[model samples]
Target chain A: MATARAADEAPAPAAPAFDVKNAFRNICGFCHEDYGRKQGKGPQLMDNPNSDDYLFNRIRNGKPGRMAAFGGAFTDDQIREIVVFIRKLKPNENP
Target chain B: MKRHSRKAITTASVAVLAGLAFGAQANEGILKRSANDWPSYHGDYKSWHYSDLNQINAGNVGKLTEAWSHVASRATRGLQGFPLAVDGVLYYSSPYNQVYALDGATGQMLWTYKQKLNEDLVAKQTHSPYNRGIAVGFGNVYMGTLDGKLVAIDAKTGKLNWETKLVNSEKLTVGFTGAPLLVKDKIIIGSQGGEWPWRGPIFGVDAKSGKEAWKFFVVGGNEGTASDRRDTWGGDSWKTGGGGGWMPGSYDADTDTVWWGTGNPAPLYDWAGDEWMTKGPRPGINLYTSSVILLNPDTGELKGYHQVLPHDAWDYDPASGELMLIEQGGKKYVVHPTKAGFVFVFDRTGKPVNVYKGVDNINFVQDIKPDGTLVGRRDMKEGKHGNLCPAIAGGYSWNSGAYSPKTGLLYKVGFEWCMDLEVVKTTPILEPMAQLNIGANFTFQPPKDGPARGHIRARDPVSGKVKWEMKFKVPPHGGLMATGGNLLFIPEADGWFSAVDAATGKVLWRHNNGQGHNGGTITYMAKGKQYVATVTGFGSLVGDAYGELWGEPWVSMPKDAGVLKVFALK
Candidate 1:
């Protein structure tokens, strides 16, 4: 029993919550409407539900001649996190 | 019997005269002349964008109607190029390196040349792959691509004659967005990579063979080259100094020199940006960039240059505007509407004579020296967010203005917006492929006083006085096309192409065709009928980049199907 003394270890820190508001204010909101209340260069994203597949492809591959693809800029996890934040966006929400 | 004979003979004579007139106008188009055909960008060597065709005059412009429209299948972004008209066939270039030759009279698709550009490669470009237009010379159509290739296709067959790689995209990310200027036997093309970590260049190629003739480096201090002005730059800053030749240059046959406006210097905050705990590397006035450079058209030799913005950080590009050669007080002067919102008049020897504040909100420079040297603000170098007028888009943009030899006035569209400026220390954000390395960031801020607006200004080139200005709700995006009938044709970003009174700035006629009209206006005649044509759509790097401030209902408006709108008087 003495040979099997338990060693104290710190559990992996929980991943920091994604700052969708900060990301929206700094990057996405520059081109799209802030909080998705109005249309900017890109279409309004509020009150609209897009499939995960459609959102993933559009964000990764981008619609040529219209939008810039973020697949290369953002990682798979980061993009997924962004999509999650986008899904939680409510119409008329003042971000 | 006598009356019938007289009527028949008179009718025969009138028909014969009409046939002769048609032949003359047709020849003008075939020969690439300016008066009757828009053979080149800016309409002619004078860069006037004016036509002597009076058929669609002020009295008859109200009757102008859409004759026909051809919807292009690809490269359907905003059409920014001036379609070249020659021998009844109209040729134009679109985004993604697509070329189309359409029937000038019927809008029928004659032939289309679609370049197999790698979308992955094009996505790496710093700017949109929109080609301003094609150059017609040596019986071939010439165009520069976003992938950095100079292509020549047979005008009649649309066959690829030759394709030459002008700039290596891997070494330095660059693209061609302006039309190539066919000067004499040489096809002069300007490269667009100002926003990248690049050493810009202006290349002269043999028109017939597509062989490189000469190259003029826009940024100075290249190793083993005489253009080294190392003293002007601190450390090795000259290696990546940004001074691109983005827009098509104007040539002066009188001086046998090519006059091109150079873009802003690299590290937009080189002189500022203390928070990054960094000082500007290129400390002295960065030569060549943000200036009007004069060079030998054949050999690419630097003759002279005049810096319009010394130590500039607001991304003010002087070369995006038209360079007008005018005679004031029996002397010749080059009138350039600078991005700083000033109409700068320089003598033929590259000496600044006068600077006039064309817009009301330009507060960056308090004064301009007699030789066109700029006086910078004291706070600009302090690295603090300060309110700067005319924004980064400035009072005017590359939507080149027109100078009417008839009116002695220059008609240009102006923006009345400003931006915020400051310096930050952090890793530079690089776009895909490191195509853009802008060392700092700024935001387009609307003026605190009022909503942003645009103006259609008629300025006298001699006195630098505004004769009249027509304000609008939306900022205009296209250039001006003046006709001999005292009409100035311009398009708005809000989807209306209107014809204004060239003399008084009166809105004579406007049509809401439901498309953001940002393409260059061009006019040509076929069979004695005058037609004014421009492309309409809603995608522009400038328009979209500043969408938060200038776009609203504009971005929400239903866009047109990228139609080649050709109007003719009924």
Candidate 2:
């Protein structure tokens, strides 16, 4: 009975971690092209991933106050990319 | 006092400033409106966002590179400031009310005055984290703090001359957003946060002593309307009313009358709750929420006014723009551009003369009737969710629109792209960024559409016509300005600051500044050399969406993250 149960159980791989660079390139729309500034809309997410949740909440919300909201505007997966991108720019990792 | 000579009132970031012609003494503000010295917001209150030096005009502006960039450090200070230059010194109020004086030619820090802040300093700044900036008057520069204090410092030495607690928000608290307005020995300033049961008033403070000279409250705005508010607000419209004068006002020294526009009634969306100030004799007009209200600059007495948005339900604030008075055809007409999309022209008598819709993609006001009665749009309904045009941020938000006296046109960059908006009723009490209150603000969803997706248009003041417009990759990132030459500088939501032919509306040149812009553009002559400057700190409501929508319109320049970039052609 144990051998039969083991045969019935198939394995599933875990979800991958959000890639900071890929997320950034995805948003920046420029892969391997580091345009330090000049990227409009929202400035570079560089090192901002470590910001407190509320600031990120406000930033991701689209509208800060009386502006507009983006709760449903972006996918959660994409947002995870934003979080990862901010993390990748850790000074220790880069230098 | 000829028209062209008055053009020398130089400044950066136009703030609905105004002026009047005086004797030909060349005594405008302290200096000739140089192309480098941003003497006052809107130059010198003549509200001419125009500069005198044509050094960086259409011809050679191509060589206009970022001459100097003061990128802010996250821990040191944020760049939520408008740099005010007097002669060769540049003064700016940075994050935490830290004042920095920089050299005009080079963005070199000369002196720094950091206002010590405790942990509680973060609490007072719920509205805007940073001060709009400081004001330069006489020989001193003035600034207000987040912890509730206004300090005056020697403009040259950066030494504290006097520090006064104007309104201790610690009790009955409110924030300061209206940049200080200095008129002679007095400075006129008002506070924001009118929505929060906070008492709103515009005061005349002694410029030197920091003593309060006069205070004007909006609850009882019109002295002539009798003491019994019940008579003025026939229905229960006067109670819990929230008309506040939040921005710096304009003045006519000759007439001794200072004019300011007040904001919308409180519990913003609930007209019924705040009916005491809304319903009755002053009912629709509401005794000046959206009007050009005049008072004796010294007395603070109600002189005269004309309502622009009677019961501004659409959240279309006429109070956002400064009462910029423009003179043409020997007639003194005040051109007060409203966030609601109308550039309402009124004679000095406070009578509406003509109203023009500066933007076409607006659904805020129904129509500016022949009699100046805003019928309001017919399809505009309450308690529903749908796409609203021109957004509550407005067709032309708080960004200052400059007028080129040389061309007789109001050079403006209007935020035309709209949002799908839904209004709901709410209580007066609102938490900072909560999920509870939905009344005062409408739900907006920015649309996918034409080049007019948040655009910038040039208009004729007298005719109320769109001369030519440059659609932004997204909404206009900032405000606009015109110079002595045929040049109009406008910013795009995607981070491109474009210079257009002020005459033909042609895109003369465009350059990227790394991020989208929301700050206004200003010009001045520094060391006899003219320079044009603007601030970019995108990522607010408009920024996040447009950046997401248009992909990318600018290249990232972290060195200038939310900085003041001054440009001059080589």
Candidate 3:
């Protein structure tokens, strides 16, 4: 649950932390795994860190009817870290 | 590994363990028989449609033509329930609870078992529809009615052996939609009420005497705990929870256990009651819904459990596809493809070693833990709707999936799609009350970009990696089979039959079967030659919303599209 924020308190800024292989794993379950559509227990992700609104709300609030929530277990800054990582995710020439 | 990427790799050992425990053999195409036999619905309980016959390889498949086709008497309003082939005799069930016995060699009807559908009984049922298929064991054929009655017929003669009513269709509107899976002497079946407020369960009946053997519920109610899911809603959705084992279960003879997945929780659209599902993983992993549940064939004991969809609010039921068993490098495993667009590999212990997201365009959760437990985002946990990755129907739906031992690859088919689903509560409920099922207008939404089409690919089940990939303009559906001739037989929804190179994932040959396929494809050796068969008819969730999502062309009229096309190698 999002608590009422004070004027002094604001959402944390994004962190520079990122998994080095972010892009290669952007569509981690891509290609042959599900013939591409078999997303398994989890849905696919984007490489574009700019896909954050779609990412945070998806990861923080959780997309209903499809995904569940995780904001409580994870800190807003930690989530932003993931969003940053996703934005830079790009497939290398070969994994 | 990617930070948020869910690992879909399960070591071969885990798959074998899950396979042994569930009594389902490796789906590596080992337990596969000649395509002609169609011995088991999934060809010998293992659910692997792999055939040894190489006559119809890519080399000769181009010359292949449809030898014969048997169209259904009436257009199928919603045809699900696959057929059973034994000793060249094909036994199939049609909508309205009708069963037909056919000759596998020639698409000829040898006998027909019209269930004398009790319209009055069905009318009273929440969603009285028809039979899925039947099981043949102990010299008798077992079939369940849309109204929840289990009937046993003699194998040789179309005579009724015994009948047992499993559920009162009026009170539950729950019945069997999956073909009866025969394990040793027991005929295992499940009921359908996913769309309704009926209890979820898989029922086992004595194959010989038609006696009630055991019943394993997907949702818990008997324990009498409000915290227990079955008591949550305290209403029909709570009571019904739609545990229909809509898809046939896979049995591993070695394990003596049955591996089956459960359907979606009821109340169709609104999953307010299925709270846990809205959260990370629903409580109890919904017992059986979207879970790989193990049942003791003899006692029907629920030995172990693993959930594929926790608190399934999106209707991404794991009940559709088949459970394939594979053994890699001496490690055995249970291979399963879910409607949620996942190609999951689990250890024999039912532990999630790895889970990989295959869909390129889903937007639900970010990842899965090493234990196979799902980690949901905080916001999406509660029953609400938005840009859920898979539109409940998931990356893949009620079609078949396959594996080729020769290449050690798994093949899954489907349209990569998602939607903006908003679960609004329905008032007064729709009639005839739809057999106490849940109701949801699963609105169709395409991916952020690209055409709304599907594809089929050959995958490395072990690493959750892709070996080769191919695309289809129309959404793809059905199971796939790889053969000795280095070919993959794929039935498509684009009215074409195809053969792809087993190793490279190349589309080597194609045939216009004339219609899209719904069920999986199977191959066998008949008359010293190899022949392939696929069931082309729509059923399950698609039939429920055929008109809305599929539109007019792919639409289903009360009875419009139903046919079984059998092809042979010259």
Candidate 4:
């Protein structure tokens, strides 16, 4: 096996503030359809009955076999932003 | 060091003799495909998915009854692997790299082997756990694992002989869900890719020693690749251009070439519109991705290639379909179905012979000419676009169709669906473990002509003329099998396994396996008796949409369950 690359060991550069809408469209929207306003492969995030803590944990550590864990891809703050985005989701009246 | 060299020489001598004996059998078994064995993933190198065993014909197919059943453990996304039979023993794989050897006639479990996997990585993956199939050759069963390793187990003892890590799955977040194709002395396997932002690679490994011999990247050509070919991807976009030969393609022994179809580039939906040639997440045609490539099995060298969809922005992968080798009027042709609802016919030299629509819902392009040029491109911008024909699930998903030499027709499935998309521009994530770079949010919808549905069509593969078709409310997401008995075995997405008369699309026998079918089916002779075997289960990425698109059975179907159902004349 090859040794770990120096790039991997080096400290990660500071990233821009997470954009929940774009991120959701890129990743989460694969299963959660309509920007989470309607259900598709996953449950609709709009008007969700789950609590903040539930959403946060689920996003970080996903349900096995049901959803992929995004914790490695997203920070805690980013996941919280996603939870907030879910809370604010509403039907696109114009769309 | 001197003593070690002496021992290595001794081992090499023994391996060569064993290889000589095994290579002869493997070549004959795979190239000709004995009536008693379903040796390769495509049944044979022709990718016919057909068996010549005719004990159970259409006249007596009604007398067929369940011989036995084996429920596989940890069938996470249902049993999605094709079962291979050799002699009287049956070998198959399930989720989590679980391999099982069974008595093909009795379903008696002989032994089971499960690979130790990196559970954490599997949990973070969108496509995980399930193993599509296994290849048996040289007295070992070879399977590619979810944790980026190709493992070979003793076909008899079910013990590990060797395990070689081929990919950095912990970092790339994708591994092998497809089966490895055993060609000659090498095990050829491709990694899972498409949305992940990394160069998808297909590896050629030494079958005897489990050592990686060579690797070829499908996204961008390797160092040995021509400079002009490597320049197909603009700038550094090729560095993370997602493409993979995710499925097991067939071989043309006459030409001594292995044909493989590659996945689409990453960030599936490009928002560059018509400026895609010089702008977007990845500019240029993205060379080998979304194309049919021919490789030399011995050297892993690119022999020839045809880019089916140049600058494939719609995520329509040719990788999902089977590379069927057919001959007509002394001309050899390769019939490949692209996920974008079109079937591309290519000659032995990788030149387009013809291009035709497999599904009616396509509007991604006004037409793909016989010369393989895109006309009237509907490149979407960074906004909402309606009626994107053939939803993300694709017109043709990963499951394969069967071609019958007897009927001279191809039996395949075509999905009818569309989607409304909202393309978003996002940065490619590659550092802390790769993530899906879909670049779009879409909802599944019915096509303009009808409700979202599927159908089975018997057509002239080269000419694209439909002889007959059978429609379904929802597409069956399983591999098809045709037999010399003049029967077509279809594993339905709604839990019904039916045998239809190949001559006339009439259902002769039906059995409910109690779950949706999304894997493979084949017919083989075990203990001098003809038997049909199919893996039953559902919950594939494509089938996952069924719960929301349709109600009832799909919503209630268990995603983590599967059964290997076998049948024979009672």
Quick one: best lDDT, which candidate? 4
Candidate 2 C-alpha lDDT tens digits along B156-245: 556676766766555433546557777665777776633544335667777656777777666446445432122333233344455567
Residue B21's C-alpha lDDT in candidate 1?
A: 16
Per-residue lDDT over B197-239 for candidate 4, one digit per residue giving the tens place of the 0 to 100 score: 8889989988877879888899777875552254667666777
Cα lDDT tens digits for candidate 2, A18-91: 34332232223221113212222334444443465653464356432222232332355655555555545543
Least well predicted 10-residue stretch by lDDT in candidate 1 chain A: A1-10
Give every prediction's interface RMSD: 15.5, 23.2, 19.0, 7.8
Question: What is the overall TM-score of model 4 with all chains considered together?
Answer: 0.94
> DockQ of candidates 1 onward, in order?
0.06, 0.03, 0.02, 0.30
Model 4 error, position B496 (Å):
0.8
Q: Sort every candidate by lDDT, greatest first.
A: 4, 1, 3, 2
Q: Which residue pairs of candidate 1 clash?
A: B270-B280, B276-B425
Strongest candidate by TM-score: 4
Task: Output the worst ten-in-a-row residue range by lDDT, candidate 3 chain B.
Answer: B1-10
Q: Which prediction has more favorable lDDT, 1 or 3?
A: 1
Q: How well is candidate 3 docked (DockQ)?
A: 0.02
Candidate achieving higher lDDT, 3 or 4 = 4
Score each candidate by Cα lDDT: 0.69, 0.57, 0.58, 0.85
User: Higher DockQ: candidate 1 or 3?
Assistant: 1
Cα misplacement distance, residue B254 of candidate 4 (Å): 1.0
